[model samples]
Target: MSSDALWYFARGSGVVSLILLTVVVALGIGARSGRPAFGLPRFAVNLVHRNAALLSVVFLGAHVTTLLFDEYANLRAVDLVVPFIGNYSPFWQGLGTVALDLLLAIVVTSLLRHRIGVRAWRTVHWAGYLSWPIALAHGLGAGSDADTWWLWTISLACLAVVVAAVVWRTSAAFEARTDRAVRRVEPRLRAGIR
Candidate 1:
């Protein structure tokens, strides 16, 4: 395939990943907001959120690796991690570097959560929110196929996940109803226990 075609194809992948990343962030927000204080049964929510974040990371890995191989991009694996390591676009490279910093912050915080303290770790972990926008900007700025229909579709889908998550968390009725459901279940019966 031609480099242009491959570049667009990679951007297509980027679009899908953007949605996945958005979902991870949204779920992370929900999982964070519904702490023990809300008495909203956060165990499952947190679990899903954590898994979502991991999946997002996986998607990001795929996106970066694929981009590196796109002949149109003079990107190395180090460029993905080191930000401005790309010789092609110095300004966009800087943006990538910032995004890389955020990704690293999130990964390091998650891995060291115990030592960092929950509050501090969570605060740092919230940087996942910044990763999407930075990535979106990089895709648009550096991607050769930013205008492709698939790319737009993916971007919109990612936007939808963020919107849905915000709506769900802010819904008073949903929270109250879910809380009642949890109460009905009984504590010992919570985790598939008899």
Candidate 2:
């Protein structure tokens, strides 16, 4: 493929990956509430979340592979895995590397959740939250299209989705706690206990 094609492919895949990752993160947060999403059952929501995550990984791989092959990038194999070793924009590139490593860990643990036990898997899964922001920052700092209006719009939209999901999750948790407390207190008050 021509260098131009490779570069365009890399950028396209990266953007798609970011959008898919945002969906995965938002669905994950919403799933925690044990509520259906967009009229889908809880199981369906989970299925969509899992599939979106897988798709995001596929796009991420394509993005990385195309970058490696793109003559303009001039990236070495080691640069993909090692943080801050790239010729251009080392810090931003390093963030991408870190996000990649964290995502790999999350994927591995998820695949091995049964063998590793829930606690261990859950611990690693928490890294997903951290990885999303790092990946976003990397895109903003290192991406050629970062300065473009459309790219900023897409990025900001992704950020808004995640933030809204987080807020929903927290409010759901708080409501659950309040309900439980009310349940406990009502019985105690009815029984004449302070």
User: Among these predicted structures, which one has the highest TM-score?
Assistant: 2
| CA RMSD, predictions in order | 5.3, 4.9
Residue-level error in angstroms, candidate 2, position 84: 1.2
Which candidate should be chosen as best, given lDDT against the real structure? Answer: 2
Candidate 2 residue-wise lDDT, 26-137, digit = tens: 9988887676664578899999999999999999999999999998887788887789988878999889889999999999999999999999998999898899999999
Off by over 4 Å in 2: 172-194
lDDT of 1 at 152: 68
lDDT of 1 at 86: 76
lDDT (10s digit) by residue, model 1, range 1-194: 67777676666666666666776777676665455423436787677666766776676666666677778677776776666657778667657667767987888887999998999987887777888778767766766566778666766777777777678777997689668867877775967776
The CA-based lDDT of model 2 is what? 0.90
Name the lDDT of candidate 1. 0.71
Off by over 4 Å in 1: 1-13, 35-41, 81-85, 171-194
